[model samples]
Target: MITGPLCRAARALTELSREKLAALSGVDEHVIELFERRIAAPDANVVAMLKSTLEDMGAVFIPEDRRGAGVRLKFTASETKRIATLESEGGLIRGDDVP
Candidate 1:
């Protein structure tokens, strides 16, 4: 669980929903929420997964060390919907929180 400003910005700029992001990233949505909330540190794999997913959708995610560059994410509403559907359809999400 690694949280950083760069990661937060990426989450905000991306169209992927938290649940879908986590599922597609092979992580729990709660962990994705943690990263968005900046409450937990996202490990290298988590960062890598997120970056890869974004890149596949035509977004360029810069690592924390490379945040100074003009990296950007380009996604339309339809693309977002598509990505969400892809992730959700795969049934990657697994959670049964009682709280």
Candidate 2:
């Protein structure tokens, strides 16, 4: 059985070279690279953006706290609203029609 690549949380989120992810996420390239290489870990908000961006790419995040215990998905109520607002602003989902 061949196991798929299991990247670190940061790597999984960026899914691109540090330089590219930096441009896409509007974060510093060095900082993103450091996080992926385990030299640093981003703060909660940065991580949350990375996670949400990855979701659009069909990638899922499993918190390290819940690793190795089967599928682990963390859902934050606030994050959902943030995503909704973001989508509304981007016009991907219409919020005006609902409320």
Q: For candidate 2, give the lDDT of residue 89.
A: 84
Please tell me which predicted candidate would have the highest lDDT against the true structure.
1
Best model per TM-score: 1
What's the CA error at residue 2 for candidate 1, in Å? Answer: 9.2
TM-score of each: 0.54, 0.46
TM-score of 2: 0.46
Instruction: List residue ranges in candidate 2 displaced over 4 A.
Output: 1-15, 63-99
Report, for every candidate in turn, its global Cα lDDT versus the true structure.
Answer: 0.66, 0.52
> What would the per-residue lDDT of candidate 2 be over residues 1-99, giving only the tens digit for each residue?
001122244344445555665676677777666665666777877766655544544455443454441122345678789988877785454457654
Over the full model, what C-alpha lDDT does candidate 1 score relative to the true structure? Answer: 0.66
